[model samples]
Structures are given as C-alpha cells and as structure tokens.
Target: MPTVRLPVPSGDVWARTDYETLPDDLPVRVSLVHGNLVLNARRRPVHQRIARRLATCIEDAAPDAWQVDMDVDVLLDDDELEPSEIAPDIVVYSAEHDLYERPIPADLVALVVEVVSPSTKRKDRRIQPTLYAEAQIRHYWRVETDQTAPAFAIYTYELDDATGEYVATGVHHDRLTTTVPFDLDVELKTVREP
Candidate 1:
C-alpha cells in the first residue's frame, strides 16, 4: 500500500487553518479516522478482482432503492469533513438520501464490504467492523483472499444492538447466500477467478 503524509501534523490535516492542501488530482484512497489521515495503499490485483466481482453480484440482487459503489467515502459524522471519514471498498447505500453534497451517512448505508489483503488484514478484521457496528450500519461483510486458489473466505455479520457490535451470521468458504438487505448470491470461486 502507498501512503503520503501532509506536512501539517501527526493526526490531522483538516484542523489547521494554514495546513497545506491536497493536490487537485489526488489518486489514492484517503480517509480521516479518529484524527488520523489514512491513505490506503495501491490494491493488489486479486483484491481488485474480488472487490469488483462482489460489488457486481450484490448490486444485481439489491433492491431498486439501493445503489452500490466502490471506494467511496462514508462520513462518520454527518456534519464535518475531518477526523472521521472512512472509505469502504463497497458501500450499499439507499438512493433516498440526497448525498450529492455530502458523504453518505451510516443509516443510509445498507452494507459495507471490505476485501482483505495482506496489508489490510488486521484492520479489516478488527478496526473497521467495530466502527461499522458502532455507526449502526446494520450489515458488514469481510472477504478474505486466497492467493493459491480461486476460493475465498466470506463472512457475514449483523449488528447486535445490545452489544453495539457485529455478530457473525455465517462464514462461507465457497458461496454466500443471504437476504438481509436484499437477496444475494455470490460464489467465492467465480468471484476470485482470473
């Protein structure tokens, strides 16, 4: 993964009035979470394949009100642009929200998915899920990649309101079939194939 840091400060780029600005054509995925500016590294080939395929499948099955997008920012706070932006790999958001001027709020998001890679495995498995849960995003999915084969690990989670956390609904090694947000059917092998 690639990361570029601004010269302003350790934990923020949006706080200082005199902070240097990002380039007009920033290329990499960037986020501000918990006062830290995070730039996701360039994605591996396999990671891209899985993320796109999964997004396609889900979009096909999702309801008309839901739209699927990749590498889009979700603002943790509806009011501010700093210290809480998270760019999930795939976000299923309701079309009802007028998000043209703002990042999609958690309530408008039906599901957020992250395809795990070597560099992001820990954060994908731990940090992101917790954040999504607390945001009450309702559904979270983590896809674990398998480099040697076309089969991947896919886990589905539902928010447990009592605990403010995600509870595993199922872990699928070959296929994921669910109807939480909408009817979904995804094959791990086909999604991972070259």
Candidate 2:
C-alpha cells in the first residue's frame, strides 16, 4: 500500500477545518462554539489590555486557583452525541486540574469573563451569555468598552442553583468586588483606559 501525507491547511483554511482535523499549535486560535468554528482575529490594544488586567485581578483575588485566556477551551459537555465548546477571554478554573489540554466542563469553571470588541459586541452582549448560562456556569462577567469615554461597563451574574440558570446579580459602572473564591476588587475604569 502506498502512503499518502495529507497537506496541512494554513491561516484561514485551518480555521475552517472540522474540529477533528485541527492540528496542535495552529497559527490562529480556533474554537468550536455551538457547532460553529470561531477564528481568532487580531485584537486592538485596548482589548488586549483589558483582558490582561481582568486576568490579573482574578489571580490576585483567587491566589489558589488557575486563571487563563482565550487560548484555552471550556468543553461544556462530554456526551459523545452532543459536544459543546467555548473559549472565553478569561476563565478561572479549579487549581487542582491541568487545564491546557482541552475544554473542561462548565462545572469545573469558577468564573468566565468576556471582553467586548467592536466586531463581537452583539455576540458578546446577547449570544455568548445565554450559552454560558445554559452550560450552568456559576459566574459570568461582561466587559463593555466605550470608545468615547474609553470606559468599561462591567456586569456580573450568578447562577441560580435551584433553577440551574444565571441571574443578574450586579452591574458595575466603574468597579466590581466579589466575595466568592476570594475578596477581589476590580477597577473597571483602569482596565478600559489605554
């Protein structure tokens, strides 16, 4: 039998590949969200800074846990018949497990944060939150960026354990402090400004 080596796809083609064929360390980050592949686009400086600041805040707040960025995926379910995966901007997972390999379920995640970009405003505001809530994620935060004031609108929500759903617990115009995991305070203004 003759051996045939399949040519690897690059750039955008890599993003379009089926989940099973994606190679390790693909040039662009790819995520399977709701059966659709999301390609990582170049981010603006402000967007990058905000994500970094939020990660730092979470780390300081929960010194014992692990905090990560979009590079990691959160697999919501393991049922072979139905697979769900999402990559949020920042995710705080249990410190006890190795998170680099693949998506871990929503139960393992302590918190998820999404920093909005102009291109992803709608998806971030409407679609993504619902998905996270459906996955039974405990805490979800949305960081809205204002171009004029260059400020961030931080909104926090907590899951209703009885109903297994998320409820808007608080909305912060400038900052946020949480009691879960650890005592953490985030200055929304500092994160938004360049």
Candidate 3:
C-alpha cells in the first residue's frame, strides 16, 4: 500500500469548498481549523468504544425532536475563504435537518461531545471548546478516560452568552446527570463495558 497525499488547493488558506473536494477515502480524519488543514490519525479502540456507548446512552434519552450521531462534521463557520469544520465524537442535533446533509450547521446542533484521547487532548480540552462556544452551541461535554477506579469522567459545559465562552457546569465521575439538553442520566462505566 502507498501513502496517499492530499491534493492541496492553490490558495493562501484552505476554504470549506476546498475541504469538501478532498477524497472521502483518505486514511486520516481531516478538519479545517484557522484556514489550515489539520490531520488526525484514526481513533483508538477505547476512544471509539467510549464514543459509541455514550452516543447510545444519549440517543436513548434525547427528545423526539433531537437526534444523535457520531463522527459527523459540524460546520462552525461557512466563510468562503476560511471556513471552520470539525467532527465531534457525538453530536445532538435537530431532527428537522435534512438526513442527507453533510457538515451539519452549528446552529442546528444542541450539544457536542468529545471523548478525549492522547491524540486529541489539547484540541478537545482547549481548542474545540472555544470554537463550539464561539459558534454559540448550547452544550459541550468532554469525556476523559482514565486507567484508575473511576474509568472515566465527564466534564460538562454550557455556553455563557455574556462572554461568548463555555462555563463549566459540572464534572461527573461515575454517573452523569444533566437537564440542559433534556433530562438525562447514565452510568459512566457503561462506556467501558466489554
């Protein structure tokens, strides 16, 4: 097998349209951040496990008007020159959206979750939260996996309209309970089950 190099558009910065033209079969996950192309290797098994199980839990508790999906792009800024698009581990969005749409608009998103991994620690904890907050997404949850007794910890945040930033609302170690994205409760350990 040979390495496939991404075809870069001739421009000062990569735009949303440029990103859309990239081959879907590319081996890595690519995102447009600050007008640059950022590549991330495939997620680890534990990362995928946490995302999948947690998404199921959220979907079960979500209201009839909202839906849950994993590893789908959310378009934060649709600027022609320097658009920003990112895929979260899990996204809770309006059911009214078209089913065939790619890069779901940020405004349509109710909540976004990221299961932190070694590869995504800085982006998940710092960069992504800022982007989601700036886009005014209502809720953000970061799941930090641990090798210790707790297994995982979920840090929840809500958008602060006054400052346009996320304010940490709660941190749950064993169980997660929240009412903002609709009343929901789940045992964090379920994400680690075999």
Please tell me which predicted candidate would have the highest lDDT against the true structure.
3
Tens digits of per-residue lDDT for model 3, 17-90: 78889998888898998778999879988789889999999999998999999999999988777788999999
Q: Once all C-alphas are superposed, what RMSD does model 1 give against the true structure?
A: 3.7
Q: What TM-score, over all chains together, does every model reach?
A: 0.84, 0.79, 0.95
- In angstroms, how far off is 155's CA in candidate 3? 0.2
**Model 1, span 1-194: residue lDDT tens:** 46645556634345322222545356666666665667778798878888999899988888889999988777664433344668899999988977563567787898999998888977899998887887899999998778533657888999998998999999899788898988888777788788
- The residue pairs in collision within model 1 are 1-41, 2-41
The TM-score-based order of candidates, best leading, equals 3, 1, 2
What digit string (tens of lDDT, one per residue) describes model 2 on residues 81-101?
A: 344577788988877657545
Best by TM-score: 3
Q: Which ten residues in a row have the lowest lDDT in candidate 3?
A: 144-153
Q: Model 1, poorest ten-residue lDDT window?
A: 11-20
Off by over 4 Å in 3: 147-151
lDDT of 2 at 52: 89
**Per-candidate clash tally:** 2, 1, 0
Deviation in angstroms for 73 in model 2? 0.7
